[model samples]
Target: MLKFVIPAVALAAAASTPVSALEVTKTATIAAAPDTVWKTIGAFCGIGDWHPVVEKCALSKKGDKEQRTLTLKGGGTLLEEEQARDDKAMSYTYTILEGPLPVSDYKSTIMVAKDGSGSKVTWSGNFKAKGAPDNKAQEAIGGVYEAGLKGLSEKAK
Candidate 1:
């Protein structure tokens, strides 16, 4: 009885602990058609052309699994893999396999949709804080999304 009680109490305490999961979504209105915007940014490795912080992108494939290695301007690399893509929907989903971000289990999607005569682009992600506070991790991801969206808008213009 004592052993069972102790184990149950520990399990309850652990269950009560909060998880550091976070999500971020950022959007931009680009003055271009959805297809045009998608064409500009939709390639798996095209981020290097539109993202200001990305210096280059190296793409690889292994048995139908597509991955990209992004080299940032300040000299860090992020390895990511494409999980899904829909050309008709103008969206793609990807996950970070390794990176210097302040989060782990990171998965993200970028989508473009018709908005009036232009297009609305959304970049969103979900992850858990790693080696950082929740707010700081959120802020970091938000900042990246904001910058990337701005760059995409400029390029799509």
Candidate 2:
């Protein structure tokens, strides 16, 4: 994963006094098959409905693929560009094109695994920031991940 590195002064100007990169992982068990879960997770427009923190996602044209601009209830927008997509591999990667947190080179992948009676969904990402330190950003990102995962799990029921 490529880390988004932000310069200290610029980072402070962007968010607050401190900025740092964040790595987050969140997982949840869904009472659906991997394919069913994937259908929901990969649906760009339906994301906000399942992810509690996201109010909506605005999509724009980007050649053959699409671009996503996610508005979070926390007052920031996430701009992500799809880097790769493979239904056979059941994986896709996205890079943060722009964001308020001074996040750069932000990349993430969602992995699905069959677990007996259900499926496990994992959301993971890596990125860097410029203002504070790495740990703070990590915590914030973790919270985001947890909230999304929890919402998905609830909706999956």
Candidate 3:
């Protein structure tokens, strides 16, 4: 009886704790130079230009934060706010304000760096699953990153 009670108590405590966030990261090597890669994707709304699924991007300002509303090809929209940006570092970070993604508290960063004679682009994100299992959410984000990186690579060439 004592052993069973202890195990049940532990299970209850664990169930009450919040779920940990999951992360997905994807990288690609581009034939272009770092500076040139940054110039191609540096703008806040440039995702529309290089992300294959993005159909349109509308930029707007809210207080000091720059926000972009991305209209996706199949008819979904994502509203994201720029959290941090540094052209010198060739990196920018953003958070989802509202979107159809299967994750919550989603924050992502994209960075470009010199790799040998070309550039390496990295895109990573952290978030908790929402209305879906962790693996599903991770897969969704991974697919998005993969598609975007592929598009970016093509544009850089």
Candidates in order have lDDT scores of 0.94, 0.74, 0.95
Worst 10 residues of 2 by lDDT: 1-10
- Residue pairs in collision within model 3: none
Per-residue lDDT of 108 in model 2: 83
User: Where in model 3 is the C-alpha error above 4 Å?
Assistant: 1-19
- Candidate 1: where is the Cα deviation over 4 Å? 1-18
Candidate 2 residues 50-155, lDDT tens each? 8897888988868876678989886989877777777766667777787766455578887667878888988899888546467766777777778887877777
What digit string (tens of lDDT, one per residue) describes model 3 on residues 1-157?
8999999999999898766779999999999999989988959999999999999999999999999999999999999999999999999999999999999999999999999999999999999999999999999999999999999999985
Candidate 2 off by > 4 Å: 1-22
Q: How far is candidate 1 from the true structure (C-alpha RMSD, Å)?
A: 5.7
Instruction: Tell me the deviation in Å of residue 27 in model 1.
Output: 0.4
Candidate number that wins on lDDT, 1 or 3 = 3
| Candidates sorted by lDDT, best first | 3, 1, 2
lDDT of 3 at 86: 94
Error of 1 at 37 (Å): 0.4
